[model samples]
Target: RTVTSKMDLLAFHTNTPNESLISSENGVDLSLGSQPLENTKVHFEEKQFVCSECGKGFTHKSALLTHKRIHTGEKPFACADCGKCFTQKSKASVLKHERIHTGEKPFVCLECGKRFTQKSSLHKHERVHTGEKPFACSDCGKCFTKKAYLVVHERIHRGEKPFECFECGKYFTTKSYLLTHERIHRGERPFTCSECGRCFTEKSSLLTHEHCGSAIGCRSCTTGILTLLESCAKDMRPIGFSLSHITYCC
Candidate 1:
């Protein structure tokens, strides 16, 4: 159940003809005989089609053309349902993305009965019940249930902040953090409270405001600590506690 590395994937393919390669069905290898040669010169010389932007060699010109879209930021495959575009023109990706709009769960787990839009997600979720952490950090012995989680954790040891804030000089280990930081620079508050016409940088802030503002009817107290104090004031007022005394304690 271990995740495949880039080298493992590359090694699976050989330039030599009929090398007796291992085959897999549902991630289970049928045969494990005859180990493939590693770090062979044929791998570099044999790949005819090469990418201009990244210099990644591809076996076919069509693969290289499909890969060029990664550098160009092109997503030609547009979903008719939601207008979302995808770089990979695969039917699986189109089907998976459409599930977001359709609220469909095609892949289901037999263990917990939890459903997922994609097969990969269901595969990852099955690891939770099995307690199988296939991805492990090389620097530290910390393991992750998902390969992406392990990759993100390795950045901490490598001191690699791949995501950079273009607005400011700040850098982040993850893209989501960089995106959240960019909102601050752009003064973009996407999360809004429908009850009150107030906006927040994060959705959790809006939820907290809504919880407290509903009881106190004070949407002006946007701060979480202030909302917490107001919530406590409402509860304590019933037990013979003065607002002045509560304010002094705060």
Candidate 2:
């Protein structure tokens, strides 16, 4: 039903199920029927949804797109202050985007006292204490609280690292990660921890530090994270992400 190339969508049907046609030029019109349904005439109203219904309403389709951040779990609206991402791609994309211009840490974590711009991010950060593993891998016995970490874990099983940097002779599992690593050379660190006054080159590094601090850090961070995987017996004793009770030493 779907092709990799461009195609047009066509619509046809009323009250009942009907197929639509595809046209390259003319956009599909999703209009309601004029007929009645069980002694009830079709209202055929503009079909304008209310704000309270969808959480909020926007005047433009693009505005509606911005509104959809409340759903779909998309954070196109990223925070410059703390590198937190939001799903809603805003009209004045400049305002939200510019926050990144000035490093801000307005959003704070009540659990750990870490600050962030996006509430969703604070929620994710808090999971470290709660010891949550909501995202699990079907192929293997592994779990992660964050979707991004799950993706990175999938890449490990897939044995894929798409980005290779020529300058540093370093390879990265993802493009954005590789780009962040490049900042080390550029010295473009925008995130700093308030408690210890430790600055990080990448937001990801900052995130990792929150969980895996050091020997003490990894020990504490993995405490909550490790228990979640014990039932699987899949052996999460890998290098950076997990710990093993026994070390080969050979």
Candidate 3:
């Protein structure tokens, strides 16, 4: 008699005194010798449910339905405060955004006691103490603590300035620079001098004004002061200049 199934093979092996046996199953022949049955690779779960949009396969129907949201752009989970939508897979994104309104920092670092709104932020912050830089640039082999830092470093090698200012059509390497440039177009002077209540578009300009106490030293500050002086001359206003009292002239 021929063994067609694994159970039959096992039972035949136990009863028979043969050192080897030939078994056939699903049109495939198996030579069962002195090798253990545990060594055989037989078990497998087929992915029956397949995505029509991306052609990705999943073992369960629920998983396939969840993955379909990526192609459909369906975000069921939304924040009540901001009404910002997020995918079901990223339910944590909604929670993180909610913490911004609540000012809740649940994740805390044990080493430094620094609190973070998200667990991922806490993990990234812990790297500062651990000195572990996993993300490395392919071109320069320079390692960075965060993957975002590594991505920005790689952009320098590729000369990719993705961030652009819509008002002036100027490109910037980083989003922070683009945001600072946008402040000029908006006439927003957020950085204020404590001494004179003077506002500046950039933090560096504020620092320079604080250090020099006058616009005479810095080039950008001098240009701005010259323009203001030109306006004062047109108005027939007398301007007095001094190092300690620079606000009197303006």
After superposition on all CA atoms, what RMSD does each candidate show versus the true structure? Answer: 11.4, 15.8, 9.9
TM-score of each: 0.51, 0.38, 0.63
The local distance difference test score of model 3 is 0.72
Which is the leading candidate under lDDT?
Answer: 3
lDDT of 3 at 214: 46
- Which ranges in model 1 have alpha carbons more than 4 Å from their true place? 1-76, 83-90, 111-113, 187-200, 203-250
Per-residue C-alpha lDDT of model 1 across residues 46-133, encoded as one tens digit per residue: 5779898989988888889889998999999888877888887898788788889999998999998999998889999999999999
TM-score, structure 2 vs. true = 0.38
lDDT of 1 at 126: 93
Candidate 1 matches the true fold with a TM-score of: 0.51
lDDT, candidate 1, at 115? 93
lDDT of 3 by residue, 43-97 (tens): 2235779999878998789989888988999988777788787767465666688
Better of 1 and 2 by lDDT: 1
Q: Give the better candidate number (2 or 3) by lDDT.
A: 3
Off by over 4 Å in 3: 1-43, 89-94, 204-250
Q: Candidate 1: what lDDT?
A: 0.69
Q: Which pairs of residues collide in model 3?
A: none
